[model samples]
Target: MKTTIEKFAGDTEGVSYELTVFRFKGTSKTAPSAYIQAALHAGELPGVVAIHALMPKLRAAEAEGRILGDITIVPAANPVGRAQYVFGELEGRFHLGTRTNFNRDFPLLDRPDKAALPPPPRNATVDVHLKRLLVGLSVGHDIVLDLHCDDEGVPYLYVPAQLWPAMQDCAAAMGVEAVILWDGESGAAFEEAAIHPWLQLPAEKAPLEGRVVTTVEFRGLADVYDRYARTDAEGIYRLLATRGVIGDAKAARPRKFSGVAAPIDRVELISMPRAGAILFHVEPGRSVRKGARLATIVHTPGEPDGSIDILAPQAGYVLTRVSKRSGRAGDDIIKLIGEARSARPKAGALED
Candidate 1:
């Protein structure tokens, strides 16, 4: 086991952030290597605690000489977002300085090599530097897991459409409730950037089945509990063992994934029609019929038509909702996994 602290200079003089990386050596030279990172959004901590719980298991495996492949972990991936707090609330999703998502704008390498990455510009912000540093550390690996969490949702995975059926085993091993498959581009998100380089190579040189890449949403943001962390840790360990990154004779065989598997276009981003306090009639993991009342917005308080009802656009499964009760007009208030392609299919990533 080894630890490295990488420092990146901040936009101002004498300001900097440290990114800690951990590495574990393997006994077999032919085994596939893996990379796991958590909290890229900074405030999302489900993956952070899960990684904390998973370390002891990896240490034990190393001690027992059961670790067969290289493993690298970054329990907290974003030191820049980790320090961003506005007024009293934690602002961790987008970089405050550049207003760019910490997970977006990653360098899409031409090939799966560090040399293929372009040099950062002299005027690049700290966020850009951080993205490049993360890509450099992960692109060379065979498996990459960028751990994150949604606002208020069940455990799920955002897998590239190219890696769907092959990555289902990983999804099943992680015990997530849903799997969303996306194709083309996702604003050059980390998952898209990680797989972009490999797809450039021929199938013989880079068999798609041998690689694993995903942005794991470990349930909602507030689900950072010991029980959930332990469960998620075990799920990840199961994947490592199943993928032959580590040897675990007693690990159970993964069953077929039975969760909702849908394309990115099938998702419905139900936005609020009017800005006001919301009263949700449905939560995540629930089923709804078309035209069912999903929520009500108190737009004009103390009036006859003071509120407006938000109904389900179609029969579907509720995937997530905004954590806040209040929202503005046109803000996405909830997400629904419709039975078919959405009436208004969306492109790119799910959110900005």
Candidate 2:
């Protein structure tokens, strides 16, 4: 239950981020050491609520010496984003001035050559820097959970496909109903950029060699500071318990969703040819057929109202749709998902 506040290098507003660590003082090391970070995207708030609710229980676990190894939790991980707003509307999703999503751009560092280290006595900030230091800190852990929430949609699990069935089982144990196995290349995402090098086998190897990492989406945006977010917190707590970070066996166990990994084959993003006010005809997590009427744009007078129909593309499940009713041209529509369909679009189709 100890906490430390450190100022990030680029922070100018005097806002400090707290990093809390919980562990039993006198206990044997546990199998899984983990980290939890929330509020990376300020507008997406559920993770904040989830962490607050889980903290008291974590403290109790620490007092009872049930906590095994280190578990770090950073609830308000992005103070800058949290503070960004305009006329009561959240401007936190994108950078205020540049309009860029902060979560999309983190620094990437490649592995350093063994011979490159000058006896570990580098005096320069560039050599012994925060990026290198954080990388070193993360390499020792079993798992890193980056807590996130969608702007509007059902909760889903996002893990590097490299982790496979173990991660799938873990997600189900945490009560995550839908899991998306993402194989696309990630850029500058906080969780991915921080640990991707360690997960790689070599320069361009297919298999990862180190610990498993995942970014979990709990639900939609705007509920982070509230009580309902506890669902995700409890789910993560169960996951930690199952991994042996906490001593309670009952807390560690949970019911499984049959064929947890099989449904992952169905997740797909249906893009719009042109975007306008997104009229959603189908809600999230529903089953839809191919060529079903998904949404109809409200046509303005004197203009051809472009009608958008979301075909399930393949017969499968629907996970989530665009949260905001209004959309600019070229935005993505609901992500129509179904199990493992070869008809899924290739990478180039998604590229601009």
Candidate 3:
């Protein structure tokens, strides 16, 4: 195991970000290589803590000569976002300067090789440069995991449609509650950028069966706990072993995915009709019948019919809800996986 510091100039003078990369060398060249990054949004710490717990296991494997393939880890992927504190809370999802999502708009190359990436523009923002650096570090790996978390939700994964069923083992190994398969475009998100190059080539050049790439939503934002971290770590370790990155005989086999798996279009992005405080009736991992009351918005506080009930669009599985109690008009409040495709489905990401 060796540590490498990746530094880049900030947008302004005397400001810069230092990204730490940890590498684990393998003895065998035939084994698959993996790259795991956490907290691309910076404040999402569940994956970071999981990686912390996983380091010891990797070290043990390294000491015992069990590491068969090269592995790279970046526990805290965004130092810039980590430093962005507005008033009191951490604003890690979008960059302050560019106001762009940290995980979106990544450079999509035509090939899996990093050399195909062109140099960043002279007038590009710091976030743009950061995206390029992340791509350069993560491209061409057999496995790439970008760790993120929803506002409030059960553990889930956003896997490209091309990798479904093949990636079912990954979902099972990670012990997530659901899997959302997406195709076409996701505003060129990191997951899309990671797999786009491979999709351009023939299967003979880049086999889909052996490749693993995903955006793992490890429960919710406030779910950072010691036990959960350890459990998530064990899950990731099991995946590495299952992929032959590490030779671990004791790791339990991944079970069949027993959770809900559906296309991204199956998600019902329920929005608030009016601005008000939200009162949720269902939590994550719950199933709802058609027209079931999911939440209520107190739009006008003192009137008898002040609150408006937000019902289920259809019979579906409740996947997530917003962390905040209040919302403006048309704010996306919850994600429910419906039995059928959404009537009004949009392309790209679920949200901006």
Candidate 1 vs candidate 2: the lDDT winner is 1
List where candidate 3 sits over 4 angstroms from the true fold. Answer: 252-254
Model 1, range 150-261, lDDT digits (tens) per residue? 9999999999898989988888889998999999999999999999999999989998998899999998999999999999999999889888899996664865788998
Compose the digit string of candidate 3's lDDT tens values, residues 1-352.
9999999889889999899999999889999999999999999999999999999999999999999999999999999999999999999999999889998999999999999998888799888998999999999899999988998999999999999899888888888999999999998899999999999999998899999999999989999999999999998998898888999866746568899999999999999999999999999999999999999999999999999999998999999999999999989999999999999876778989
By lDDT rank, best first, the candidates go: 3, 1, 2
Q: Number of clashes in model 1?
A: 0
lDDT of 1 at 332: 97
lDDT score of residue 27 within candidate 1: 96
* Local accuracy by lDDT, each model: 0.93, 0.61, 0.93
lDDT of 3 at 190: 92
Model 2, 116-214: lDDT tens digits are 223323442221232333334344466677777775666777776667665755777667757766564655565665456555446355234335577
Please give the TM-score that candidate 1 achieves against the real structure.
Answer: 0.98
